[model samples]
Target: MNTPYKNAKLHDCRDAFTATLEALAGQNSDIVAVCNDSVGSSKLGNFREQFPERLINVGIAEQNMVGVGAGLANGGKIPFVCAAAPFLTGRALEQIKADVAYSQTNVKLVGISSGMAYGELGPTHHSIEDFAWIRALPNVPVIAPADRAETAAAIRWAAQYEGGCFLRLSRVGVPDLLPDDHVFELGKANMLRDGHDVTLIANGVLTHRAMIAAALLEARGISARVLNMASVRPIDEAAIIDAAHATGAIVTCEEHTIFGGLGSAVAEVVVDHAPVPMTRLGVPGVFAHTASANTLLDDFGMAPDAIAQSAEALIGRKG
Candidate 1:
């Protein structure tokens, strides 16, 4: 496995998201979009042009946007609540918990420009804590799709899913790792590469990075397994357990904070079922500085080389 996707084309997941939503809207009259004045950032211009009346823009009001999404779902309309991730989850978390999750509404919460996608906007706009925030609620599935294919698949799944769910999407361009026909299933992890020395787990934009890291480890004669753990909440516990037992070491890399996110979720599973040597790479516990998403990620030691190094070190500690 020496980098099969070296020449893969880069794509913005937002394009796949909006395109998929527009297609779904054409078929389902009940499908609607609610936003917090984020039409451009959410890339809903075409959607608005096609279905003007269905696009509800609650100007700059995050709480009201969530409330309206819930109201629409109650009125037999499927609402995809689109907004910036920080405000969508942080400012209106109460509405998300009370109106959607607790009430069990069929609201599709699409957090656009999540993670450090807001790059230069600093920590105020960064949605690093979203996975932790939404995953703590009941009746909701938290997902961060890895590529364009996965993003479209997850959006299609959300449209049909009964209960409330959060779909965290990054604006950063990423290569298509999953196949076009890949179907997204809830709470399951996709094993991209298999090995026996160590396991590399990640999601969202970090999945491909993990693959690159696996290739780096392979070059150094270390067999590394790579897992795309997109479904964060009901994570693939079985996959995590198997990787732990098989590889004896685990390294989780995410665009989120080290606490209460992808790393924490994997660690929870490992500590519960099979204890293993692990390393969690992320923001570690601080507000990220003003920089591009990838720059901040590399600065925080999430680069492929850093990930490979962490995997090598963790493998050494596996007693």
Candidate 2:
């Protein structure tokens, strides 16, 4: 556990993502970046300036961008395909499945401003369904890092790993939670704070909120364990089972939907392994209204206090 993250400075995971990519490219000449003309949003401006020839902007054609990434990987060059989450996952899902997942290419799919990060841009821009869309496919490890440190680590891990991966990133600023030397481990959940009353599991932007919710529960004499579960697919089944048996109850909070996202993935593990009283907090099964990213999350009842309340309620149903 790092220092109590109260009032810590905020950081966008994309900045750390691009910075790590640049540093990795410095050492490996086979690394290349393919994007749907998202240089500014993907934070690849510096990378474009550093490696002018290596940055391939495939205009607004997301499908073509993914195909090009696959081709680059086929040629033994590592390709980080960057684009808005909605377009990258929604528009080019077919290409992602056939070219990257089925072919098992070494392509890094970076979904910039995922979840409700583009909330003000309406539901069309919101990429909340990405978890279900990509998690359904094989040969693709779905990951969403909780902080900049974890973001950098996951990026580095994807660079060295052999197969395809989906790194879901948010543009919304969040305080760092993990230590500076934190390493990216696939299918492993990091327990931020331990408790026996109820477990709060979350990742990406919701991990910090889970920490705060844990503190709030503690203040009320309820012990809440906090788990930063960055990997959605290849989920930490052992940790989820342990949390269920140890805590007796669990509450999953995520920026995506409760239907088929982090919460759904965790529930699938819990249902098969160890059944527990679980409440998934996120955008319910409805299109979200236009609002700021944080405002939409709060509106959908994923605020820290709301999460703590959900955890407390779930504990009551434990049998």
Off by over 4 Å in 1: 1-7
What digit string (tens of lDDT, one per residue) describes model 1 on residues 141-171?
Answer: 9999999999999999999999899999999
TM-score of structure candidate 1: 0.98
Report lDDT per candidate: 0.94, 0.93
RMSD to the hidden true structure, all candidates:
1.6, 2.0
For model 1 the local lDDT of residue 202 reads 96
Residue clash pairs of candidate 1 = none
Tell me the tens digit of each residue's lDDT in model 2 across 252-311.
989997889998999999999999899999889899997999889888888888888888
lDDT of 1 at 300: 96
- Weakest 10 consecutive residues of candidate 2 by summed lDDT: 1-10
lDDT of 2 at 205: 94
Winner by lDDT: 1
